[model samples]
Target: MSIRAAYIEKMKLQLDELNTTMDELQSKAGTTKIELQEKYLKEMASLREQSQGALDRLDELKTSGEDSWKSMVMETEKVRDAFVKSFHYFKSQL
Candidate 1:
């Protein structure tokens, strides 16, 4: 695959990992007992850290290229904006 394709694939993998971490944190928030809540809180914090690390890696990859990386950055920005719009729309409905 081309360098741009490789970068995009890697980014998708990182985003998937971050999504999993978010799911875990959301699941933990639904628990009722105090002990379970604490457990979830700890797990959520750990997952949050992991997700942040993945995001940092993504940023590093995104900026590391000289030519094709520009396209990747532009496309990624467009997708990010779409995601934000979708999120905002959903939030408004809630």
Candidate 2:
């Protein structure tokens, strides 16, 4: 497979993992105190937005030609890293 294809596959896997983590987080939130639940919900909503942005970036990368794919990869990485960090922070709070 070409480098672009491999990169796209890796990104898809990352996104899947992030989604799973998010689901777990949501499940844990159910047991949180009612007052805190509102805060957690807002944070989770932001994380979901970040995840969607990464997916959108991946879609762009898939259609981009060789020269432009690299840039998209960089932007996607930023979004992915931010989401991961936010997930960890939320988990820590619980």
Candidate 3:
């Protein structure tokens, strides 16, 4: 695969794994106290939005032509990095 294709595949896989981890975290939150649960749910919603934003960026990169892929890659990385950093922070609280 070309560099663009390889990058897209890697991002897609990583995002899929992140989604799964989110689901597991949500499930585990069920046992938390009511007050903490509310906070956890709100954070999960924000994380989901960030995850969606990353997916949107990845889609934009995927649809871009070879010429535009260079630029799209940077935007994609920013979105993905933001989502990942947020996820790790949230996970650390758990």
Name every residue pair that clashes in candidate 1.
none
Best by TM-score: 3
Compose the digit string of candidate 3's lDDT tens values, residues 3-94: 77888899999999999999999999999999999999999999999999999999888899888889889888988999999999999999
TM-score list, all predictions:
0.50, 0.90, 0.97
* C-alpha root-mean-square deviation, each candidate: 10.2, 1.2, 0.7
**TM-score (C-alpha, index-matched) for candidate 1:** 0.50
Two-way TM-score contest, 2 vs 3, winner: 3
> Which candidate number would show the highest lDDT if scored against the true structure?
3
Q: Better model by lDDT, 1 or 3?
A: 3
Error of 1 at 10 (Å): 4.7
Q: Looking at candidate 3, what is the lDDT of residue 83?
A: 95
Please, what are the lDDT tens digits per residue for candidate 2 over residues 13-92? 98899899889879988898999999999999998998898888889888988788778788888988888888788778
Tens-digit lDDT track of model 1 for 11-89: 7775675566467546746665787667656755655564555565557555666766676576565554444454344
Model 1 spans with C-alpha error above 4 angstroms: 13-21, 24-28, 66-94
lDDT of 3 at 5: 83
lDDT of each: 0.58, 0.86, 0.94
* Model 1 deviation from the true structure expressed as Cα RMSD, one decimal place: 10.2
